[model samples]
Target: MSPMILIALILQICVTNVITGEYSEVVHNFKSIRKNVALSILVIDGDESNIDSSSLSSAEFVKVPNIEDLYIINILNSLDKNIFTSLHRLQHLKIEENELSYIGPAVWAGLDLEKLSLRNNQIEKLDNRAFDGLKASMIDLSNNKLRTLPNKCLQSLRLYKLTLANNQLEDIDLETFGPELAYADLSNNLLTSLDVEVFSGVYALLNLNLSGNKLTSIVAAPTLKKLKVLNYSHNQISVIAGNAFDSYNQLMELYLDHNQIFRLNHQSFPSIAPIKKFTIDHNYLTGLSDELLNALDNLAYLKFGGNPWSCKCLERVLEFIRSNKIGTDYCESKLIPQGHSCVNYYDKCYGNETKILSQNFEIYKNFIKHYEC
Candidate 1:
């Protein structure tokens, strides 16, 4: 009962309508509300240039044209064909910071819109029937100025969550996506390359944000039998091709943090044995080969703080990160775990009654030690 007091009691019984001037004052502020007292969010302060489907066909002087969430603060460039055929119980449509270039194909044919945000728009292009009769679950064209992605303007949608993050998208036509995609935010954008024909369509992709983007290498990909999160982090990646995740078995999180990964290949995560959250922080690693640390086993988290660790084999990778406490404080919030002059030096146990340096040993006099008897 305390999520900020249930969001302040659902914002005190949801009711918002910020309609601004001109454009016939949005049907004179929907004829001063009162058609069965309704309004659960319908902010419309637009008219910076256009938006006139004959002024929403004066939605019967909408006191409650049954608006189902529709925000349009400053709609600019275009969109006026059937502009929501009299808002038939419209279903969530936000026209963010507009500079919207165009959107024709009968401007949303027969609306059943579930959600559609033209996020920050400056929309560069989108033609082939721009979205013929949009059916949505989610479509936030993040930031926008899309460079490419026009294979029949998102071939007949029935979207499933597609936010083309920040944008200047370099390429994308994963078979005109739509096999009930589960989530596909193409982060940052300007993708340098990637087209292992991503699972030859039939996508049910489970979260695939190609983070930052300008990717250098990570090719091989093929069988994404329902992928489960693969955010190829800020990139310029230096190779990670071992069939770059043809991994099925619902692959769990795999982020390759800031990249240039100098090396990591022992059949790179052979079928990621149910991997759990594996990041490769900063990158350009100087050491890591215990067969890629026993092919990363059951990791709950292994962020590998920044990289460059080579004091001639930094204690066998700090003895597998201190015998598995593996939490190098992800980029510091508290990290004191790094050693070199043959750090901690451990190796000795000859039965009968053994006890050596379990208590005191701090030798550093022109030091040089190694004992195996």
Candidate 2:
């Protein structure tokens, strides 16, 4: 499953067990909640040896040992050090599609997990005391083949949700991410850039996915003003500097959509950001600056469809995104130009003519000679 690790995301325990023969003594129920242990050991199809204690030939876990959510799917390939030291109330573990490559530190010696799932797997390496004493607060080492990381490896966990999306990460050391990392999924991976001071030790972020990867630009970050969901869609972004997001104003979902943007000004952003849901959509944008359309007047949601606009100086922000349906209903028969009017460049069709921006593609009309009214 390698095409840069597609996700696995396990956890769907629907217990039943209780067959009582041919290697039984498991006993889970799940509805009336008897749960005497048998928290999913689905060996994808059994036999090949690797999981110890004889694949847990259930001595009934030494008699009903109140286990807590454990699911060891698609079996065998490594991991035997301690192998769940008799589930001391295992606080949720997942161990995905396996062929575990290595993960010793006596495999979480005295577990303290609050959710850990070594997704997919073939772990390329990890044992900087592989989680010294567990203390996990959600860890999913996405897929795997992990390349590097050891700044006190997870600075003694206090994590609050970190996925390390698809692994083989190119660079990360968010100062050993802590301060209650509030959800981060370094999407895909092999990030090409990101030193916004590695977010000054995660200032309580709320979701930040650097989608796909190989980012090209989007810097400014006043330690991310408590981001509320930010995804730099796909990547290869074409510069988006100036306060790129320093004031985010508690952003509520913002994606820059596929990149290579063709221009955007008015100090780039923050006319008092109150973004509710926004997308820059396919890129090469050609207009928008009535103070970024009045800072998108609290859009409940909007996606700036493709782009190449300049539709008569963006007729009042495309009539306020086609009268608030948000995302222009097919831009008047597909991207304007069927008799539209807003006279001269800045005589005002929503002031300063939203910045006369129609360099009709030819890669920016050869040398940018616009005005196709």
Candidate 3:
């Protein structure tokens, strides 16, 4: 054999050996990355990766199929399911945007969690003891297909924000929430009515939203001292009790829009001096008495459009508009065209043409300075 041919053969063998050993070395390094993992929380934001972390092998993690949010639908369980329990330090878990319908209890057997978020999924039912040892700060089951929330599913959450919005919930016992709750959103559900005692023990509550439900009336707590914002929109409410807002001294905003309310009497609100905004639009109101709104002395915004106004009693409101009390252009909105004067009294045309009802619009000068309308 020639000397040049012998050198060429040796070079070819060296190149082949390097190519064969590259893939095996890469796999070995991947196994070392997931060794002895220990942590309380984990956020897995993608799929198709060999994670062999030693320090986080036992942690709880909020795992998604991929950070791109396209892995689960792209491949049918391409990743191994055993990766969920590889984290030893994981206590709180939040898995979102995955193709998960139901989670087995054994998948999270020895975790210590105080928060969990399973939003934007298709979970229909939660099993008993599925959340047995959780001490979470909050849990979000919103935007799911849940028909009923098992009382036990929330028992372990000693105190936290619980959101169950945009679901198929038809019934919920008020007492199902834990004592440490500071906020709750049960809106956009099939709930017909809420239990009054549901808020009895929650002292830290600051905001509550029950809008877009089937409630015919509101039955709020009598001692919700920390309450701030209460939204009860898009319901069948026709009646409002006078003492409904008695205990909420710190209340700020109240929404009662899109209901069947035709009247509000004196003492309907509990004289909340701290309240700044109140909305009562989209209803069947024909007239408003002064006594009904006298208690909201600090009111800044009062939305009252989208209702049939009686021209007879509207002289007071028209005069207020002309005097710029509420500062809103409601009278000029084309819904009431004859300008502010006709709506002030033009409806009493035929027999009572000369009779002008006594309405004092002068006192509203003080109200105009406070409210821009």
The estimated TM-scores of all candidates read: 0.31, 0.32, 0.66
> Model 2 misses residue 66 by how many Å?
15
Clashing pairs in 1: none
Model 1 TM-score relative to the real fold: 0.31
Ranked by TM-score from best down, the candidates are 3, 2, 1
lDDT of each: 0.64, 0.64, 0.59
lDDT per residue (tens digit) for residues 1-373 in model 3:
9999999999888666545542111222222322212222123433444433222232222332111111111111122323444333444556665555554454445444555677776778776555654445777889888888776467555756889999989988656777677888999999997788877777888888999998988875875788899999898787788777778889888888877676665575777547777777666555666655566666666666554455655555544433434433343333233454544333333123212211222332343333211
Candidate 1 stretches with Cα past 4 Å from truth are 1-76, 81-98, 101-120, 123-133, 136-142, 145-161, 167-179, 189-203, 213-225, 235-248, 252-255, 259-281, 284-286, 289-292, 296-306, 314-373
Q: After superposition, how far is residue 63 of candidate 1 from its true place, in Å?
A: 34
Q: Write the per-residue lDDT of candidate 2 for residues 1-373, one digit (tens) a residue.
A: 7543433222112122224322223222211123344432311223344433223333334343556665655554676566566667768778687678778775676778788888887788887777876777899889888867766677668889988788877887657687778888989888888777777766787888889988888756676678788898888786676668756777878888777676665576676677778777566665666666676677766666555555555575656665665543343324333344533322322232223223324465543355332
Q: Rank the candidates by lDDT, best first.
A: 2, 1, 3
Best candidate, TM-score: 3
Question: How many Å off is the CA of 159 in candidate 1?
Answer: 1.3
- Model 2 C-alpha lDDT versus the unseen true structure: 0.64
